[model samples]
Target: MKSELRDLYQEVVIDHSKNPRNFRKPEGANRSAEGINPLCGDEITVHLKLAGDVIQDIGFQGAGCAISKASASMMTAALKNKTKAEAESLFERVHSMLTEGPKSSVNPEELGKLAALSGVWEFPVRVKCASLAWHTLRSALAGSGAPVSTE
Candidate 1:
């Protein structure tokens, strides 16, 4: 990554961590799931208010590392008003980015602020932190009552 870009990414992460967006359970949420990273003690709950197959709203609340908190905030911002299929597709793209690093095939512009998290792939352990909210979001969307665990 270029120096300027790396700095910007760092700033984005820090800003989100310090002041996360959508960090609450939304009213009228019909589905919700919790995620825990036992390895790092990051825990989050993702909530969704769905109208048919579309996510009318999304929110999350948790106590965790910066990556987890920021990921939850960004995930909520990204998934709101998106259809279930679109949300699933975005999850796959983000999972790939967090595990394998950013790919040229996935345009950063498509991910918006989420692309800032690409740098997290370098720290494998932190991947769980970055992904906890996403996994919880999926479980919530799936209507799975089980809590997600990164073990």
Candidate 2:
């Protein structure tokens, strides 16, 4: 990545981390789940309002590293109005990007601004921080009350 673009990505992550979006529980949320990253003490809760198979709304709340916070914020934005299948596909893409080595080919354009977080692949441990909320989202969508653990 070019120095200028890297700076921009860093700026996006920092901005989202400092003031995460959709960091509230929707009153009518039908599903919710919590997640923990034992390695970093990052805890997150994901809430979802589903209309049939589509996500009518999504939100999150928690505290963690910049990557975690930013990822959750971006996730809610990406998932709004998306179907469960679309969200699952997105989650899989992100999972591949995070775990399939840094060279993994996940199209940034397809992921939108969330592509900025791809830098996380460089730090294996930080990958947990970035993935905590995503796991929680999956659990929430499944209507499973069990908390997710990224151990």
Candidate 1, residues 25-106, lDDT tens digits: the string is 8999999999999887778899999999999999998799888888888889888899999999999989888887755366
TM-score of each: 0.91, 0.91
Off by over 4 Å in 2: 1-9
Full-model lDDT for every candidate? 0.87, 0.87
Q: Which residue pairs does candidate 1 place in steric collision?
A: none
**TM-score of candidate 2 versus the correct structure, residues matched by position:** 0.91
In the range 21-132, model 2's lDDT, one tens digit per residue, is 9999987999999999887688999999999999999999878888899999999989999999999999999988877655678776578888888777767767888888
Clashes in each model (backbone N, CA, C under 3 Å)? 0, 0
Superposed model 1: Cα runs more than 4 Å off: 1-9, 102-104
